[model samples]
Target: MQLGAEDTKAIITRMKRAHGHLGSVIRMLEEGAECEDALTQLAAVNKAISRSGYALVATGLQHCMAEGGPDSVDAKKLEKLFLSLA
Candidate 1:
């Protein structure tokens, strides 16, 4: 299912934040930051990415359920996608 403009914007915003966090983590590593500090930044980046993934999956599930009900193939596909992240 196609995403509405708002959902697409929200997803893109999440991905952009994740991208920025990843860049910061890379910079921290390159700058010889403390291991603990670097690890903390890395964890933040990981969480941001995970949140983005969850948002995408949630949007897909929402659309699938609305359009085809919970038992539809699209819903199953979205479920698999979400589980793969785990």
Candidate 2:
């Protein structure tokens, strides 16, 4: 989980993009935009954030597994980690 500057920057970039999308949803709501349109945008933002989070988790797991070697594949821990994310 100890990401270097470049890796951290990549995560930050994804977060910023998600934030921007969230802001757009807020702006649309504040402007009294169509409900369906706003909901659609909200869904898109949610999907983006979920995808980004999963990607980060997968990257972290991959790095941990690599460092920890073959025995790192603990089913219980993996299930816990995934459930906690959910």
Candidate 3:
């Protein structure tokens, strides 16, 4: 899907932040952090990544649907695309 340059940059920023969070979780683990604390970080990182991916899928689907026209081929293609994301 084609995204505006600014929108693409924003998405990239979100992904980079998520990547950083995962790295932090790894560093914390290496330092032998508490199990509960590590687990919480793990959950947060997972949620962040998942949310980012979902946002991309939603935006792409919206764009596709808009371009494809109501109940058109593009919409069906977008439905499949969204399902794959799920």
Candidate 4:
């Protein structure tokens, strides 16, 4: 789904930060950093990515509803999309 800046600025920023954090996580693994530290960062990156997915789904749903009205939304599809994130 196409996202406008207004609808996705925070989400985009979060994903970008998570992208950087993932790189760090990879580097930590490559350098054999402490397991606890690496795992902590990795977990944070994972949660950030999941949150981004949820936010994107929310934006898409809102856009669909606003543009096409509530009747145009397919509940089954929305549920599937949300479940995929889970």
Worst window of 10 by summed lDDT in candidate 3: 69-78
lDDT (C-alpha, whole model) for all candidates: 0.83, 0.81, 0.77, 0.93
TM-score of 1: 0.83
Write the candidate numbers in order of decreasing TM-score. Answer: 4, 1, 2, 3
TM-score result, candidate 4:
0.89
The better-scoring model by TM-score among 2 and 3 is 2
Candidate 1 regions exceeding 4 Å error are 71-75
- Candidate number that wins on lDDT, 1 or 2: 1
Give lDDT tens digits, candidate 4, residues 1-86.
Answer: 57788999989999999999999999999998999999999999999999999999999999998888999789999999999998
lDDT, candidate 2, 1-76, per-residue tens: 4756765677778878989999999999999999999999999988887877777777777777888976876778
Q: Report the error of model 2 at residue 31, Å.
A: 0.6
Q: What is the lDDT of residue 84 in candidate 2?
A: 71
TM-score, every prediction: 0.83, 0.83, 0.76, 0.89
The candidate, 2 or 3, that scores higher on lDDT is 2
Q: List the lowest-lDDT window of 10 residues for candidate 4.
A: 1-10
Least accurate stretch of 10 residues (summed lDDT) in model 2?
Answer: 1-10
Winner on lDDT (1 vs 4) = 4
Q: Is candidate 2 or candidate 4 better by TM-score?
A: 4
Backbone clashes counted, model 1: 0
Clash totals, every prediction: 0, 0, 0, 0
> How far out, in Å, is residue 16 in model 2?
1.0
